[model samples]
Target chain A: MVDIPEHLLIKTAEARAKALGISVEQALAEMKGEAEPTTISKEPEVIDVKPIEVKEAPAPAAAVKADIPAEVDFAPETRVTQRLLTVVKAKPIQKPTSEPVDKVNTWPHLMLPEFISLMAMTAFLIFISAILQAPLLEEANPNITPNPAKAPWYFLGLQELLSYWDPQIAGVMIPLIIGVAAFMAIPYIDRNKDNKPSKRKYAIMLWTFFLAGAGTLSLIGILFRGPGWNWTYPWIDGVWFDDLLDWVHFE
Target chain B: MKNEKIKFRDRVKDISAGLGDSLKESSLWGSIFRPGSPFRKGYSDSPRNRSYVVMNNVLYHLHPVKVKRHAVRLSYTLCLGGLSFFTFIVLTITGIWLMFYFRPTEMAYVDIQSLQTSIAFGSLVRNMHRWAAHIMVIVVFLHMSRVFYHGAYKAPREFNWVIGVILLLLTLLLSFTGYLLPWDQLAIWAVTVGGNMASYTPVIGAQVKFALFAGLEATEATLLRFYVLHVLFLPFIIVIFMAIHFWRVRKDGGISGPL
Candidate 1:
């Protein structure tokens, strides 16, 4: 048997003490089987059982008629009686019902990895900042719109969609309805309780398909699309995306 | 005579040890660090103390006392979520530093040029901010994908996934708003093309576009608008959603599964 936690032991001891009208120390000792159980003295108190019966009637229940020949003898011959006392909710012995989990203290186990990752990220960020200067083109001139002006890289896929479909659907509706709403609704829609990758093949396939499509479109938008949003092979045309000019120039 | 015989180093060590004992017994020190703190005088390596190490501290309370053994495995989570949050903190620090030198008017361009040229650590900070922002978008998206693949969003965790999606959108908006702050040709034109998409919204298209641009087109007003949204408004909102998102993660039974 597992040793009871100190806090739980105290709680049970308190409950037992209150029920038996004994000191908590005595209750604990009784629970440990070191002391005898506290017995109630029956002389001082009267038990009020709701069922109407005569007082001290020499066990009238045991004197029932036995003259009926059709039926065999019933019940016990002894004049037995029982009475209720204070209701004690605590069990006689502590039982740990929950399965013991495989767990470790989170202080050193989880935090060490988190701290190391943070340090690595900081080093990586500083390294990139030193090498690749963030592009800052000339001042804003509304009159001179850069040919093939592009959105930020994340939205570049939507811009690519705009070339194939109407702007209302590609730019507005698809991102709002499909991108935001559908993405949010994934967990609710996928009712599969099993989390194993092999068991969730359909979801994996759908996401992979989306990943491939989105990746291809965004890559094309970021690298292949030249002046006038026309397709150009990045290797021959030289990449037109100014956002990545530092990295491209480095290459 | 005995003091004269003792080494100078030994006397200093004895005095310092007495001071340490006195400080530990002081009421102020006792009040500051709780019982479970490693800094506490009587702290010892015990199961109860280990649990208290996390539960008793303000920062450590963000985590539970113990976690499923597998959750601590670095390969399981890839630490993408933590990296995303850390990148945000980095951007926030660097962004604030950039703000000290940057003016959000037409002078924004001149300010940036001088920042890269004259100011100490200016160009590097700006580069950190920009690259971190870009990295944040990718990291946040990857975190979501990681959650999905783990099916961490199932059953009781479904609502947290929705919150995660909202956080991702907020991240994108935060990045997009910051893009226009430099008031450069690259900044304004990219924003213009993106804002043009807002004009295609079904009914309130024109209103939304006008509201976003703060005029018929990108102007000084639009720059001011983006600056406020970038620095103040969006961050305030995102932090609230992020709080709920993180709280929900703990409430939904930590990270997902062994599988």
Candidate 2:
């Protein structure tokens, strides 16, 4: 037979304590008391009867056939049993079980109509495109200059900027520098770990100011500035609206 | 027999305990496959958690979950701001299609005439390409403005902002090059004035002009060079920067947050 090591015995005691949903320290203390009966008798006032019953019950069953003297151990068991009987008699009785009933469904499932409408609108657009036969333009005319050799409408804003400063600086360099500076500083400027938009005040203010300035400048340039370096005063050349009206009349 | 049964029972218990320990040691389920299992519960499961499952998921990694949603919506004006990019695509396709029927020599003027009259929808294609190029420039500017307004140019994203600025320049370069391809008198004078501006760039102005015109004046070589730059070089460069711009957004915790 293999001898159980001291460490294994401790581990087994701990495992048993955990299985019974009790603390290992409590189990160990009770086991120590069992090893020395005189120690328990000397401090009988301090001894916990509940833990003693739990620990002693499992041990006596294992020790009964091992020829341990019954006189020393029978006293504690008898005292524990008498206390448990009195406690059980003092408790109120629990009621017996009743019959089971079937569960009734209270909630109904809901269907979404918004999703159906979206699908219908998408199908309608597709159908309309198929029915209308719009012709693509003629071959590319590299030679024939259209009457108004206009830059795309969006560039009209930047082209307007070109009217105020050098093309290299105003149209290109300033924009480039600003873009670079802004991109690099984003992480550092908004370092707060907050994800909510309302929490980030400075970042919002910065964006708003940037948008207003760029939009206003670009819009003003597009509306007021004409082609090339011709910075004719509105009083001399007439307002842009008058010029547009005159052009319309000529056409 | 009783001794043998006791020995077998002990061996089984030991083996079961050893297996349980090995399972815990190897982290068979937690480490091998279960995502973010070892970490604290809510911390790993939060949608904004960048380090956990996002590090492993192939597609989710492409986009940051906790983006400055307001910034992106306002920045590019949602993908309708992508209309400019779409217009660029349109121009490229139409430009290449036009090249099939048109030539770059002094004969380019007559070739353009033949293309309009002979080729089906040829004039329409040219008009669309021209209009689209104009639209693209406008859209790109708007897109840039959107980016700026959102403060997307600040830190970490600064390089992408620079890339965007370069892309804006490339857009203008594309426009300038395409301007000369028409081979008209207007194209001639415009290019001449533009080329002269290149010559006014202080030192090496003449050299820059020479490089741009490919000679003393805007000739066949100039047209070819402009065509290549407009269609080939600029597009290639812009695409590279555009990819970097998008990837950086994912890296920099998605668009700048609201102030």
- The top-ranked prediction according to DockQ is 1
Cα lDDT of model 2 by residue, B23-113, tens digit: 5456553455335322322222233333434345553344443333243332235443345555666677788899898777767777777
User: For model 1, what TM-score is found for chain B?
Assistant: 0.87
RMSD of each: 18.2, 19.1
C-alpha lDDT of residue A113 in model 2: 22
lDDT of 1 by residue, B1-259 (tens): 6776355324322222434877887999889988787667766656687788789999888888888899999999999998998998998899899989999998899999999999999999999999999999999999988998898899899999998999999999999999998888889999999999989999999999999999999999999999999999999998899889888888877878888
What's the C-alpha lDDT at position A102 in model 1?
A: 86
lDDT of 1 by residue, A1-251 (tens): 78989889889999999988999999999888899989977564444445434354356544553344536533324443555566888775778887676898886678768888999999999999999999999889999988889999999999999999999999999999999999999998999999999999999999989999999999989988989999988878778787787888523
Per-residue lDDT of A116 in model 2: 34
Tell me the TM-score of candidate 1's A chain.
0.61
Every candidate's DockQ is: 0.39, 0.05
TM-score of chain A, all candidates: 0.61, 0.40
Q: What docking tier does model 1 reach?
A: acceptable
